[model samples]
Target: MQREDNFTFLTEEPIPKVIGTMAVPTIISMLISNLYNIVDTYFVGQIDTQATAAVGIVFSLMFFIQAFSFFFGNGSGNYISRQLGARNRESAEQMASTALGYTLIFSIVLVVLGLLFLDEISVILGSTPTILPYTRQYLGFSLLGTPFLMCTLCMNNQMRFQGYARYSMYGIIVGALLNCMLDPLFIFGLDMGIRGAAIATVIGQIVGFAVMFRMSLHKDIIHYTPRNFSHRWLFVKEIIAGGTPSISRQGLASIATIALNVSASQFGDAAIAAMSIVNRIVMFIFSVIIGLGQGYQPMCGFSYGARHYERVKAGFWFCVKVGTAFLLFWSVVLFAFSDRAIGLFRNDVDVISIGIPALRYQLLSFPFWSFMIMANMMMQTCRKTLQANILAASRQGLFFIPLILVLPHCFGLLGVEICQACSDFVSLLVTIPIVFSAFREMHV
Candidate 1:
C-alpha cells in the first residue's frame, strides 16, 4: 500500500481487518526475534547442563538491555502514533529521531560500564562458580551488539506503530534467519562453544539493525535522523509518559528474572536451568499474545486520538476474546507435554522433572494473560501511563519479585516453581477493575 493509504487505514479501515493485517507480521517478527535466543539455548543445551544454566543466568542482563530498548522504542513509538493519528507528521518524525538518538547514546554508555565491570555484573546476576566463566564469555559478545540491539528495538516499534508491520517483519526476519544459520556454524562448526552463540547473536542483531534502519528511510515510514531529533522538555515528558509502561514491563522483567535466578540458585544448577528453560518457553508463548496486542495497539492509539472511541472499545474486546481462546488452547498443549517441551532444550533428568511440573503451574495462569496483556496495551496506547505502568510492573516485578523472594525461601524449590503462577493469578485480580473502568469511560 502507498504511504498515504497506509496511514489512513489505521483509523478508517474495519477494526478486525486492520488488526489481522497488522498483527500477523508483527507476531512473526516477534517470534523470529525470540528464536535467536531459543536457537542459542537449543545449541548451548547440547554442551552440558551447566552451559544451559550459564545461558539462563546471563539472560537477566540481556533483559536489562531489552528494558532500555523498550523504554526508548515505546517512548517514541507511542508519541509518533498519536501525532500521526492527529495529522501532525512533523512532531511524529521528530519524536522518532529523538528516541533513537537518545537510545544509541545510552546504550553505548551501558556497554562501556557493563564491559568494565563484567565479572562483578555476572556474579550479581546469580552466576555460580561453575557457570561464571561461560556467562562472562557469552555476555561479553552480547554486550558488543547492545547499541544495534537497542536501535533495532526502537525502529521495530516505530514501524509497527506507524502501520507498517510488514516492513518491520522483513527487517526482523532477515536477521533472525541469519542467526539461525549462524548458530550451528559458530557454536559447533567453528567449535567456539557458548561464545560462538553470543557472536552469532551479535552478528544477527547488526544485520537486523541495518535492514530496519534502511526500511525506515522509506517514505511510508517515519524517517529517524539527527536533523529531526528533538530533546526538548516537552518531548522528554511525553516520551517518559508514553514509554513508562514499556520500561516498567521490560525493566521489571529483568528484575524478576534476577530474583528468580537468585531464588533458584539455592536449589542447584538443575533448578536454575529448569526455570530458565521454562521462562524462555513462556516468553515464546506470551510473545504471540503480545504480538496480537501489538496488532490491536495502533488501532487503540489512532481510534483514541481521532476520537472514535467505539473503535477503540471494539478493538479492545476483539483482542481479549481472541487472545483468551488461544491461551486456553495453548495452555492445554503446553500442560500436556511440558516434559517434552523442556527436554527440547535440555535433556537432563533433573531439569526435566523440575521444569515439567513448574511449567504446568505457569500454564494454569496463562489464560489470565489474555486479560492482563491486552488491558496493559490498551491503556498504554491510549496514554494511560499510570495504569499501564502499574500493570506492566505488576506482572514482572511488583507481584513476581516479592513472591519469588519469599515463596522459595519457605517452600524450597516448589516455591521457586510456583512463584510466577501465583503472581499471575494475583495480577489478574489487581488488573481487571483498572482496565474495565478505563474501557467504561470510552465514548464515541
Candidate 2:
C-alpha cells in the first residue's frame, strides 16, 4: 500500500496520445490471443468437421466461464483503479488481491461442476451426437484449467488497472505464441488429436499465469499483502454492483451462443461448422474493438470516480471514433475477401458456400455495432449497471435469441446468417435514444 508512480502522469498529456499509447498495446494483445484461437480451429479442422465443431462448442463453454471472470475482474479492478486514482493504494491492493482470491475459488468450483456433468453440459452447449465425444474429450481436459483461465483474467485486469498494460501484453503474447507453436506438435506429433488442442491451451494459460504473477510482484505499483486481507461486505457488494452489467452481457452471450449452435445443428454438421468458423472470424474482429474499449475502461472508471466528468466524456468519444474507424476498415477487408477467409479453416464446399453470406452479413454491421459496444463499456466503467446491462443484452441476449430462432425458421439458412446482423441493426437503433439521454445525464 505504498504510493508509487501514478498514472496521472498522462493526465496532463493529450487524450488522444494517452489513449493511443495505452490502447495499441492492448489491441495487439487481443490480436495475438485471437490468432491463437484461429490457429486452434485451423489445426483442429484438419481432423474433421466434428473436431472443428467441438472447438466451437468448447469456445462457447469458455465464454460462459469468462462471464463470471469478467464480472469479478472488471468489478474489482474498476474500483481498484478508482481507488488508486484517489490515492487510496491500500484499498486498491486489498480489492485486487481479494478479487483474485475469489476468482480462483470460483474457478475451482466451476471445474468440478463442469466435469461432474460433462456429458449434459456438452450437450447443452450444442454438441450433436457426432460431435459430443470430441467436445467431451476437449472440454474435459480444458475444464481442469478453468481456474487458471479465471485467475489469469483477474491478474490481467489488475495489471491493466495498475497501468501496467505492457506487462499484461507480454503475458498474453508469450502464452499465445506458445499455444500456436504447441498446437501442431500436440495435434500431429503426439497423436493426441483434438484433445491435444486442449492440452496446448492449458499449457499456454499456465505460462500466461506465470508471467502475470511475476509482473504482479515485480512491476506492479500497488502490491497485495496477506496482512490486510480481511473481507469487507461493502467492497464485495460494490464490486458486484459495478460489474453486474458485464456479467449479464457475457452471460447472455453464452446463452445466445448455445442457442445459435443448437439451432445451427438442426441444419446439419456442415451448418454448425460453418457457423462456428464464421463466429471465430467475426469474434477476432470484434476483439480489436474490445481491446481498445478495455484500455479506455480503467481511465473512464478512474476519472468518473474522481468526478472528472469531462475526461470520461473525452475518453468515451475517443474510443467510439477509433473503434468505428477500425471496425469499418476491418469489415470492408473481411467482406472483400470473404471467400478467402472462410476457406482458411476448412475446404468443405458446403461450409464455404453457407459461410460466405453469413460472414458478409455479420461483418457489414460492424460500424453500427461499434456504438453499442462503446456505449455498453462506457456505462459499465461509469458504474451504470442497469443501463450497461440493457445495452449489453441488446444484440446477443435480447434481440438475438428471437431473431436467430424466427429468422431461421422463416427464411432458412440465409435467415440464420442474417439474424445477428439484423439484431445488431435493431440494437443500434435502440441505442441512439439511450446515447442521447446518457450524454445529457453525464453533465449532471
Candidate 3:
C-alpha cells in the first residue's frame, strides 16, 4: 500500500506515460500467449486439415478452462488492485493468497475430472469420428497442464493489475519461446504428431507457471503465500462478484465456440477448420486490444479506489482512442488479405473458400469492438460488476449464441460465416449506450 514505489506510479504518474509503460509489456505478453496457440496451430496444421479441425474442436474446452482462470484471477486481481489503491494492503495480500490457493485446488479437480472423462469430453467438444482420435490425444496431454496454465494466467493477471507487467511478460515470453522451439521438435523431430504438440504445450505452461511463481515470491510488489490464505465466504463472494463478467464473457465464448463448431460441422470438416483459422488470426490482432485494455485496467482500479475520478475518465477515453486506431489498422489489413491469411494455415480450396468470407465479415466489425472491450475492462476494474457482466456477456452470450444458432438455419453456410460479425455489430449498439451512460455518471 506504500505509495513509495509502483503504487505511486500507478496512482500519481502522468496518465499517458504510466498506461503506455504498463501496456507495452502486457501487449508483448498477450502476443506471446496467443502465439502459443498460433505455434500449435501452425505445427498441427502441417499434419493435416483433420489435425487442424481437431484443434478447433478442442479450442472450446480451452475457453472453458480460461473462464475459471479469469473468474478467479480477474476477480482477485481486480479486488487486490483496488485495495492497494485504497491503502488496504492486508486485505489485498489475503485475497491474493486465497485466490491462488483456491485456483490450485480447483485446477487439480478439473485435471482429474478432465482426464477421467477425457473421451466423453472430446465428444462433447464437437469432435467428429475422424477428428475424435486426434482431439482426444491432444486434449489428454494438454488437460494435464490445466493447473499450471491456470496458475500462470492468474499470476499474469495479478502481476499486471499490480503494475508489474514486465515480470508477467518475462514468464509468458519464456514459455511461448519454449513452446515455439519445442513444437517442431516434438511434433516432427520425435514424430509424436498432435501428442507432441500437447506435450510441448504442457512443458511450456509449467515452465511459465514456475517462472511466474518464482517472481511472485521475489520480484513482485504484492505476493501470494500460504500464511496469508484464508477461506472466507466474503472473499469468495467478492472474487465472484468482480470476476463474473470475465466468467460470463469466456464461458459464453466457449458455448458460442462449440455452437460454431457444431453449426460448421453440418457443412463439413472444412468449415470447422476454416472458422478456427480465422479465429486465431483475428484473436492474434485482438491480443493487442486486450493488452491495451489490460494496461488501462489498473489505472481504472487504482484511480477509482483512490478517488481520482477525472483520471479514470481520461484513461478510459485515452484507451478507447488508442484501441480503435490499433483495431482499425489491423482490420483493414486482415480484410484485404483474408484470402492469403486463411491460405497460410491450410492451403485448400475448400478451406480457403469457407475462410475468406468469414474472415472479412468478422473484420468488418473490428473498429466498433474496441469501444466495447475498453468499456467492459474499465467497468470491471472500476467495480461496476453488474454493468460489466452485462457488457461482457453481450457479445458472445446474448448476441453471439443466438445469432450463430439462428443464422445458420436461416442462411445455411453464409449464416454460419456471418454470425460473429453480426454479434459484434449488435454488441456495439448495446454497448455504446451503456458505456456512455457510465461515463456520464462519472462526471456527476
Candidate 4:
C-alpha cells in the first residue's frame, strides 16, 4: 500500500508540486555540502596561499573519487527507479544491494592504490614545489575517507531515486554541519593545519555513511544486503547503460580539473589558488541547478518506465525554466561583486584579480547550463545512452580539454580565465539540436 502511494505520488502529482517537493530537500542538501567546501576553503586560506593551492591541487583526486561513486550510485539508482515504476520490487532490491557491494569493493581498491602512489598522484595533480608538502599531507588523509565518502554518495543517490530524498538530505545535512563545526576545532584549535581539514572531512563522511546506512534499513526503503549481491552480466550491462553518462561527466570533470591546474600552475601558486576558489564558488552557485535536475531525474525515470511521456517532458521544461531564471539573477549579482566575493576566500591581490574576471566570465555562460543540465539528466534517465554520453563528454571533455590546452598558449593568463566559459558556450550550441531531436522522437 505504501509502495503504491509512492507510485501515485510520482506519476500523478502535479508536475510543479512533485518537482518542488523533491527539489527543495535536494537543493538544501547540495547547498550544505557545497557550503562545507566553502568553509573548508576559508579555513585553509587562513593558513597561507600555498595551503589553499594545495587543496586546489588535490581537488582532482577528489573529483575522481566522486566520479566512481556517481557511477555506481546513478547507475543503480536509475535502474532502481525504473524497476520500482514497473512494480518490479525484487529487481530494485537486487540492484540496491549489488550497487552497495560493488561500491565497497571498488572504493577499497582505490584506497589501496591511492595510499601506495600518493606522491606520484600528487605530482600528477600538478602540485608545485611550494605546494607539494601540503598537498601530500591533505591527500594522504583524504584517501583514508574515500570508501566512506563514496558509499555515502552511493546510498544517498539510491535513497533519492527511491523518492525518499528527505532521508538522503538528512544524512548530507548532518555530515556537512558536523564538518563545519569540526573544521575550526581540528584546524586552528588543534593546530593540525591542512591535515586537520582533511581529518574533519573524513570524520564527517563516516558519520554520514552511518546515518544513511541506518536509514536504508527502514521498512519503506529497499534494503541492501549481502544476500542480494550479484554481478551477473545482465545486471552489469544495465548498470553500465544507466551509469556511463555519469562516469563520463564526472571522470572528464576530474581530467578537466587536472588540465586546469596544470595550465594554472604555469603562472604560479597564486593562479592555482585563485582558480580553485573560483571553482568552489561556481560549484556552490550551480548546486541549485544540480539539485533541480536530480529532482527531475527520478520522476523522469519512473514516468519513462510507466510510459507517461508527457509528465517527463513537463518536468524537464519546468526545471529548465526555473534553473535559468535562478542563474540569471545570480550571474548579475555575482558579476557586480566578483572582486569582493573572490577576496573573501583569499586576500592576496593576485588571487583576487585572477578569480574576479574568471567568475564573471563563467557567469556569462551560466544561464545556459539550465537547459544543458536538464537535457542531459533527461537523456540519462530516459535511457538515451548515446546522446547522454555525448552531452556528458562535451563541456569538460571534447571542448574544454582542447580549449584549455590551446587557449592558454594563445591568450596567456586571460585564456586560462575564460576557457570554461568558452567550453560552456560551445557545449550549449551542440546540445540544442540533440535535445530537440529527443523531444521530437518523444512526441512521435
Evaluated with TM-score, which candidate comes out highest?
Answer: 4
Q: Relative to the unseen true structure, what is the C-alpha lDDT of residue 61 in candidate 3, on a scale of 0 to 100? A: 89
Worst ten in a row by lDDT for model 4: 435-444
Overall lDDT per candidate, in order of appearance: 0.88, 0.83, 0.89, 0.91
Q: What is the lDDT of residue 195 in candidate 2?
A: 92
Stretches > 4 Å off in candidate 4: none
lDDT of 3 by residue, 57-134 (tens): 887888789889988889999998899888898899899889988989989999999999999998888888889999
Stretches > 4 Å off in candidate 1:
1-3
| Candidate 3: residue 118 lDDT (0-100) | 94
List model 4 lDDT by residue over 119-158, tens digit each.
9999999999889999999999999988988899899899
| 10 residues in a row with least lDDT, candidate 3 | 1-10
Q: Comparing candidate 1 with candidate 4, which one achieves the higher TM-score?
A: 4
Residue-by-residue lDDT tens digits, candidate 2, 128-160: 999999999999989877887788777777777
> Candidate 4 local accuracy as lDDT?
0.91
Candidate 2 at residue 302, lDDT?
Answer: 67
**All candidates' TM-scores?**
0.98, 0.96, 0.98, 0.99
> What alpha-carbon RMSD in Å does predicted model 1 have with respect to the real structure?
1.1
Off by over 4 Å in 2: 1-5
| Local error of candidate 1 at residue 237 (angstroms) | 0.8
